[model samples]
Target: MNLNIKILNQKEINNMKISKKFTSIFLAGLLSASVAFSTPA
Candidate 1:
């Protein structure tokens, strides 16, 4: 039971890391897109 809990915790940590990475990438893309739109062609 304890081992199972540890494994689940590890999975949660990995998921959080993945989500954070994706969020950062998404934010970066959004920032660039806004800047591109604001600038003259």
Candidate 2:
């Protein structure tokens, strides 16, 4: 049981890291898109 809990915790930690990376990438894309729209070609 303890081993299972540890495995689950590790999975959660990995998921958190992935989500944080995805959020940062999403934010960066949004910022760039807004800047692109605001600037004149």
lDDT of 1 by residue, 1-41 (tens): 99999999999999999999999999999999999999999
Residue pairs in collision within model 1: none
Score candidate 2 by TM-score against the native. Answer: 0.72
Clashes (N, CA, C under 3 Å) per candidate: 0, 0
TM-score on alpha carbons, each prediction: 0.75, 0.72
What tens-digit string does per-residue lDDT give for candidate 2 at 6-34?
99999999999999999999999999999
Query: What does the lDDT read for residue 1 in candidate 2?
Result: 100
Q: Which stretches of candidate 1 lie over 4 Å from their true place?
A: none
